[model samples]
Target chain A: MAPKTAPSSGTSNSFQSLLKSYIETTSSRLKLIDVFLLFLMLSGIIQFAYCILVTNFPFNAFLAGFGSCVGQFVLTASLRSQVNPANRAEFKDVSPERAFADFALGSIVLHFFVYNFLG
Target chain B: MNLVLRLSSALLAAAVVHAASLSIQNPQFKITAPDASQLRSESLSLAEKPEALSLGPSDVLKLTFQVVESEERKGVQPHQTFLRFYDEATGEEGVQPVRVTPGGKAKFELNMARPPTSLPPTTSDPLKVSLILGSSTHSPVQYELFDLYVPASQPPPAHPDEVAFAPRPEITHTFRPEQRIPAKAVSAFFALFVFWPWIVLLGFWFEIGPRVPHLFSPHILPFTASLAAFEILLFWYWVDLHLGQILLYGGILAVPTALAGKQALAKTSEWRLGRK
Candidate 1:
């Protein structure tokens, strides 16, 4: 029984190793996404700092600053989803053109509301 | 046209009602002479020279006597004595002694005697007058010197009523320093919830499923929706606290921050995804 358990444990370790190798070899957009996420995160942090330091006096400026970044982030994510090969299953019928249109429409609406609120 | 006419008529009616309710009235007053007959009183006015009547050794005393006879006593009674002071410079007369008796009898004495030579007459000085009667040498009566010029006769000055400029009532109000802490804390919390959490979730979503290219990933929408709800709540709370200005300024900050986030995300995404 002990000898049999040893083989199973060894097999489990080999399986984990194989999985790790496969993940390492696979095309990982994680780095790019991380960098993008980091940029956005840093921007949000800086704006938060501005809000704290500047005392939120010019509210429209702050809103415009922050809202545009969020809108861009959403637009970019949508673009990535529409254009990425991995997302073909979900957006198979949705062309990149349509995706771009959606992005544009979403951005327009976001900016419209942002402008109204910024003032 | 109908709506405009209705609105105009409503406004006109309001104006008419307002105008009809307004009224003006002038205040009224009554004037009557004092009942001196029963009181047996007499009154006199005096003029003084040199503007102010002053007493000195050389100043002459002028006396004007008005004695109201009692109702029982007819005419021609004992002599009524009065004292008066005369300003030698302006030739103005002053009532020195005014006497009113219980029977409403009054007398005035003008000092005509030259002031003592020892004391020189002073300019614009007040002259003291005393009326003596009934052999009461110890108790001489005195009266206030009447200003020959009345205040009303003069032209109104620039500040006729100087009392208006007097100090106003002091106001006092108190506020606790800690009262602002809650508002600031709430503002910060909402800011984080509305804007920061999305950035974090973006990072998390990428880490969990690196190959998944869905923008409307199930996770992202909920987080974004939560942020929206939080933002609305904060905005409502801000309005309730009368911190609308603060909220407005916060929104302004949020805009550029959002833009910068988008730029960073796009640049990073393109760099990683190998996209132009």
Candidate 2:
């Protein structure tokens, strides 16, 4: 078990290579979604930190600020997976047009709620 | 004649149900102590029908609510808690918002501008106070999802002219809860934050949920950590709602978070800008 680096490191390196390939091959749209998701998640963190420091004096405001980002991330992820022609095979019954429409509808509804709750 | 009677009865039943659901109890009202330093009466008191309240311009009014016990009311996260003061006689109204925090009670202090002279002497209606609950007014939409298992005895609602609909109210505002915030708005936030990815998992179960391991994902883990940290900080604030101490403590947390945020952004920029 000791001398040969056959078991643990071999699989780990292969996994890394696979992930790198996956990320590299990912479309610009999907990558852009990933970046946007990253932005939203980080914004949520910033709000969270601000909340911890300043206090959530305006609870509705805090919820709206944070909730919008989280909600968008979900919507965007749905858009990404559905818009990808690759996942089309998996979701055979669903059309990408329908998926995009759902995404749009969800965003409008989520933002409407967020805007209302915003202090 | 039998069909008309059945339709009328159905309409009446629906109206009754709607009315029962919408009714609200009259609020318990009192005036706060004129002195700035005093606390309100420790034992909760509800004022009876006073012909008139002897209130000066400087006097403050107090409104109190018992925390509701029902699950529906339990987590009523207040959106904006405010007092709507209306003097019927003077026909002047004022709004003062008092934000509700996480306490087992609801209390508000409202300063009067001047005694509302417009109110009728015989009428006991003081300035009206409205407690606006959650800002979002989303009632669950009902869809006929294969309306299964209907009894054959059940009759359909009548055609348009068969049932007489009442004239709509001039102002169509839902009854806003006085104390607790409605759970409708914020609970969605909670669900979205905590369990939404699993919802995605539900659809694409083959490649998601356990397979991809979203829990440990970098994008997700940070927000979860943030929520936990924020919640702990909130708990501290709740124990003693001291703004000064909270700001001080918040400053202490912000420094490290600011640094982490900068670093995270740096890496994220690299990813976004095609560095990786």
Candidate 3:
């Protein structure tokens, strides 16, 4: 195994190929969804860090912010998976439109709970 | 009726005879120092008051008197004989009973060092000394004897609970300090910092440029508008609307949204299948 190639360079090359393949194969619609997912993940990380490093004096507001990010990310991820053509065999009965409807309803309900917790 | 009136009149006459007035006689007083030397000796007059008498601390005062009927000069033992000491300025008074023998002779001694509990608390003001005599068969009589000057005494000890009746000191309440908040500048920095993700999200979305050709179609527009309305309703709830009002409005709006979403999704499903 060690004689095959330089280990660090080989690992980096594999990682680069994987990223290139993902960007080339994934659709623009899926990439748009991935961007939203990234935004939610980053927001949650920032909020959690602020609570830990700065102050969670208004703990409810922190919970609301972090929880909304997490909840929206989960709903969006499920919608993405259900709409994904590669997962067609698993979610045969779920149409992309139906998945979007579920996402919209779930997001609205999550937002209501989040805003209630905010105060 | 005539017999009853006659009997009452006779009884009234008997009562009148029995009501002869009583008096005191040979009243004399003397004060002596603790060493047995006499400080004052005087025979009290019946009509006019004598000069005010004063005694020092640790002195002893002795008084002698006899009770008798005014008409019969014979000594008579009265049922009650009292010596009253009254302070005119303070209205404080003390009554001490005097023991009398069968022969109507009474001797009273006031030892200043061992003052009786019945002695009213005294100040520099004088006490008016008097004698009161009462008997069943004779009329009662009171005689003002003389005024006495006693050394000033400390006022009586206050009751243990007396302070409860007095006004008390005002109460002060201490409260905890207000909770601290992060500095405004730091908060503003974080607020702006939090928005960086939005720029990243919009940038990625612009790069992707996902198309939605049917988003404004009649079937999908109502569904999209209703979804936006739901978001607006939730935002309104955060700003001013109560939970109950938001829920009611949400429930009412949900009917149209669900119908529109079903119609839109069904049309999209048809188009997708036809395209495939």
Candidate 4:
């Protein structure tokens, strides 16, 4: 049992190394997406921190700030889905143009509601 | 010219109507003099004639004196002779005598001057005078003698011809107790719903659900539910107590809770992928 565990452990370490290398070697587009997601996430975090620090008196402002971050995330996710080779099953017929249109529509609707909420 | 004629005609009609109404409402009168014995009794009590000599209706008298001084100066004698005003309505008598200045100038500091006790020879009917005078008989004495015509003081008109309208008073409003709870609940619910999508998308962007697996792992369901609960508690405490303090406390709790949620979600997502 110990000899079997040793081989399995070594394989697991190698697998982890391979996964790390694959992530590192990913195209610049994927890296850009990662960076964009990080930017959006951090913006949202800062907004939440602001909401916590400042009284939520201007809740509409908070909503707008937070909503923009959400908008970015949704748009990025849609971009990822449309561009990813692995996501072909879901987005086989959808073009980047169509994805962008969906993102734009969704963002418009979100911002409209957010604007109303802010007031 | 036509407009001017119309305006003038309207004004004339209004004046005529007013005059007719005034004549129709003319006041009636009565006369009754006090007993002569009562007047004598009142006069004997004081050295000079009472400063204010109150005379009633139908009261009459005769004055015959040769004034070496001018006629104007004769009437100006201080408190020498004057008619005292008496308000029957109040029964309050004048406190000062009415003096007739020699120059026919009459003044009363505190009361109306007494009318002259004499009537001119030219008049046969007895009449009373309501006169007020002041001191300094430096000029010819000139007496102002007029009949006392005390009309019955009519009470204020029952209804004024012109009514003055006043603005109605404003009604104060107060909120009911039962309504407060639902209002607060609705507000909290709305606040959560409005911000829900934003927070969710923010979570996705941060990769919070993928990074922290232990605290928020297993599912995003519990974290979402916990947040909802926290929001409810926060709103309730805020509504029930000092909002500032509640918010301060909420902020303190939010920091750790948010971090925990992020870590849990991240760890959970990572673990799932790792397992796959």
Candidate 5:
């Protein structure tokens, strides 16, 4: 508004480069985590929409579906934090193997309760 | 269980009526069908029982009846005619009255708004409806039997017969929601079985996922105790929802959402339950 400047090509290219490099540097484990998280999130959102549309006729079924999403979110978020290089300093004392084990155990325990609630 | 009893009783009543038919005939049906069957030489039967009829949702039957005036019986007591869906000993059902016009002709309609639920295809259970002509409570001037059948293809029957019954033994005042649910203690006990995994998860989640007490640790006692206490709270909550709290199924829906709150707290620690 001040000067009507139209010279932004250089900054836009730099932004694109920044995004590409960040994506390129991210580990496959973290990418896998992203994919899984996205899956859970999208599925959860779809199920929520269906719940709204059907008005939760089968409450157990609705709960189970929603629980899967949230339960997966808990497990996957932990996995993401552990694998993320930027967050490496926080969990430095915890090895990746140990972190994976925790995620696995947590997932099993969550699903166990989730299945019971579903019934 | 009541349905079984009603059916059995109806069958027994039908058997009794069939046994009585060989020797005795009620006078009420004397004019219904003048020559119901071509067996007048064998027996003076005025009306024959309707054949086993198979009825569906859309079927409507037009049945004819006549009230004959004979010189042999100069003045007989006029009887009121009604189509009873089933014999009284069998169960309580609808009684459709047949209107006799001044011309001495009467018509009865056997109609179904929806297919019967009780009648099975191979069922020999007589539809055993009674067409009774009577003015007194226990005495009938005449009576007739009509039978029908139902198939499973039809939607569950409308107005399945119901029998009036009394409790075997009286009990004390019944109050509270749990009374409505049978075996309250057993259901509550099994709920504890479900609590083990759920409580562990809650404990883990309550600790914010970073730290977790071992499943058998005393540290998780408070979590389990709180959850167990809340189990009763959950039942009462459902009772409230079902007890005219919401419109239609809204109560049923609130149950899972309310229960999900536990999981939500476990997964996100939105409300803390203090981790060990």
Candidate 6:
């Protein structure tokens, strides 16, 4: 147990350093997008857990909630990848402004379908 | 014409001779038990009926008679000999043919153990029995014999589809139970918990503080406003607006949004290139 705790604490220390470096190194614009992505993923996981732990009687509302989270997460993730400076070589044809436009369009379409199922 | 007139006259003479009335002679009835012991014995009068005869479940009733000419007392076979049993209360009747020998003697046996199918549906009331004899050469004769009190017959069998015509039992319906909501405390807890992501998002965004210098610019603001309008329109669609209205409004809104998006993206591309 003593040896196991030593390795576990070391891993957590390294994880904390990694997080600090990421916060310091990444651009604020990318962090903003990452925060929104984190929000979407957390919201999606909560909704899914609620469905599994509790009742899904109003299944359509659950579907709208969960589907919107997943759909928006996908669109936001793609936007993040396209606008990321490190991935500029991979997405040279997709500019940050174009990616934002695509995200806005995809979000509107996703919201339309989500609202359709909200009943 | 003369031969036809002679034939017609001869037929009229034969009809007047053949009009002699017929009668029954020595009509008798005997009811015996299954073991051949006599239960009842009587002679039926041609002018006056005998006492009503009763038969048990396994009784055998034997009736013997002879059809004869009333004036000559000569036996004559009838072309049609029938025994009629009638129920006056229910108006139900059954005609059973009695086989007559060529010498005018007729014997009919009613075995209670195996009653004839020709018996009508019966009750406790007595049935009026009558004998009828008809001959082509002699005039017809009918005589009321006597009443018979047999055991009441079993009721008629019900038709296979009889229940279909009867009033049916009431129909009942079962329905699924209504959906229920979770406890208010649980619901409120989940509702508040669900909004934690919003806190995380806002708190992190505040911490990161990304700059958006051209967000409110003429080239970018119109595009942002149109996108926001699309969201508001969708919310309105969820509240009350129908699909057709939403589609029409969205189509009209799309044109301006496309124009504004092209202008905004083009300007942003120029800025990006200039910074590079």
- TM-score: which candidate is best? 6
Please, what are the lDDT tens digits per residue for candidate 5 over residues A1-119? 43444347667778989869866886554655665676677667766765664346557867986897888898889878986768879998865545654665466456545545555
Model 5 alpha-carbon miss at residue B186, Å: 38
Candidate 3 lDDT over B191-249, as tens digits, reads: 78888999999999998888999999999999999999999988889999997899899
TM-scores, all candidates, are 0.27, 0.28, 0.56, 0.27, 0.29, 0.69
Candidate with best lDDT: 6
Steric overlap count per candidate? 55, 7, 0, 37, 3, 0
Model 5 Cα RMSD, 1 decimal = 24.5
TM-score of model 1 (CA atoms): 0.27
Worst 10 residues of 4 chain B by lDDT: B20-29
In model 5, which residue pairs have backbone atoms overlapping below 3 Å?
B28-B142, B116-B157, B117-B157
Q: Name the TM-score of candidate 6.
A: 0.69
DockQ for each numbered candidate: 0.05, 0.01, 0.54, 0.02, 0.03, 0.65
Judge the docking of candidate 1 as incorrect, acceptable, medium or high.
Answer: incorrect
In model 2, what lDDT does residue B52 have? 38
Could you tell me how far off, in angstroms, the CA of residue B188 lies in candidate 1 after the best superposition? Answer: 25
Candidate whose DockQ is highest: 6
Candidate 2 Cα outliers beyond 4 Å, as residue runs:
A1-19, B1-276
lDDT of candidate 4 over A1-119, digit per residue (tens): 99999989999999999878866776555555666676677678767765675445566777877887888687787787786656758886874444544554465445445544554
Q: After superposition, how far is residue A33 of candidate 2 from its true place, in Å?
A: 1.5
Chain A TM-score relative to the true structure, per candidate = 0.59, 0.78, 0.94, 0.68, 0.80, 0.94
Task: Considering the two chains of model 4, state its CAPRI-style docking category.
Answer: incorrect
TM-score of the first chain of model 3: 0.94
Off by over 4 Å in 6: B1-163
Model 3, residue pairs in steric clash? none
True contacts kept of each: 0.04, 0.00, 0.68, 0.00, 0.00, 0.81
